[model samples]
Target: MASSDTKDISYEDLKALLGKSENLFLVDVRSKEEVDKGQIQGSVHIPVDTVEAAFAMAPEQFKAKYGVTKPLLEAPELVFHCQMGKRGAAATTKACELGYVNARNYTGGYKEWSEKGGK
Candidate 1:
């Protein structure tokens, strides 16, 4: 597990991280309607309301449902984002409480991502 003193990740850091590795796991913790409009490429949708239960599921079940591997507790980059920043921060807290110490909230969220030219 990578140790990060900060719980929040800025858009610049996120963009750089995405550029550097495919190992990063991006979770979109937005509403279904919000997600239907668009989302960060390669991100898996897990609405904020279901974050706790979703993280509690077995890896196989999570993969089956989300069509992506469930992030391991020790993974270096387990990032969450919402339409804005609030829900992502909340979801990051939930993940940390569930033992995902490396979890981080993308503080700028989707709005910033889009405005900043993120794919």
Candidate 2:
């Protein structure tokens, strides 16, 4: 599991991941309805609610639905986001507790992303 105060990336670094195809996993921990408003171009949506419900319910379903091919990575750097970072931080904490070695919370979140003119 990752440390609670582990290193975290800036929004610019987050954008660079998408552009450079870094081995980072961007997880949008927002709901479907909120996602309908807007989202990062290639984020994988895994609602905080769903995670709270059960992290092990149909891993294949999440992968297939999200089109991610990576194996269940316990060590990948997972960047989590929500509307304003609150939920994302919770999800990040949970991810770390569940053995994700590198879990991050984007505090700026979608709201800040949009404020910065990101689509």
Candidate 3:
């Protein structure tokens, strides 16, 4: 499991990942209704309420449920975000517990991203 203080990824860093990191996994930890409003382009939706199930699913189940390839269990980095930041942080902790070495919460989450002029 992650330490008491979860690791964090900045919005700028997330942008850099989108532009340059092929191994990045961006997760949106928001509800379906909340996601209907807006979300980062290319981010996979995995609501906070069901994140454990999402990650624990079989590869086929993952692909069918999330409409993307199942992210490797040992992925280099798994970035999570929510409307604000807390949920993402909690999810990050969970991801680390699941053995992802670089699970990270995007501290400046959707609200900050939008405020910073991101679509």
Q: How high is each candidate's TM-score? A: 0.92, 0.81, 0.92
- lDDT of each residue in 60-84, candidate 3, tens digit only: 9999988988778678768999999
Clashing pairs in 1: none
Tens digits of per-residue lDDT for model 2 on 36-55? 98899878888897764345
- Lowest-sum lDDT 10-residue window in model 1: 1-10
Q: What are the lDDT figures for the candidates, one per model?
A: 0.90, 0.75, 0.87
Candidate with the larger TM-score of 2 and 3 = 3
Candidate 3 worst ten-residue window by lDDT: 93-102
Model 1's alpha-carbon lDDT is 0.90
Residue 95 in model 2: lDDT? 69
In model 3, the runs with Cα more than 4 Å from the true position are none
**Candidate 1 — number of clashing residue pairs?**
0
Ranking by lDDT: 1, 3, 2
lDDT of 2: 0.75
- Show model 1 residue runs off by greater than 4 Å: 1-6
Give one clash count per candidate, in the order shown.
0, 0, 0
- What residue pairs clash in candidate 2, if any at all? none
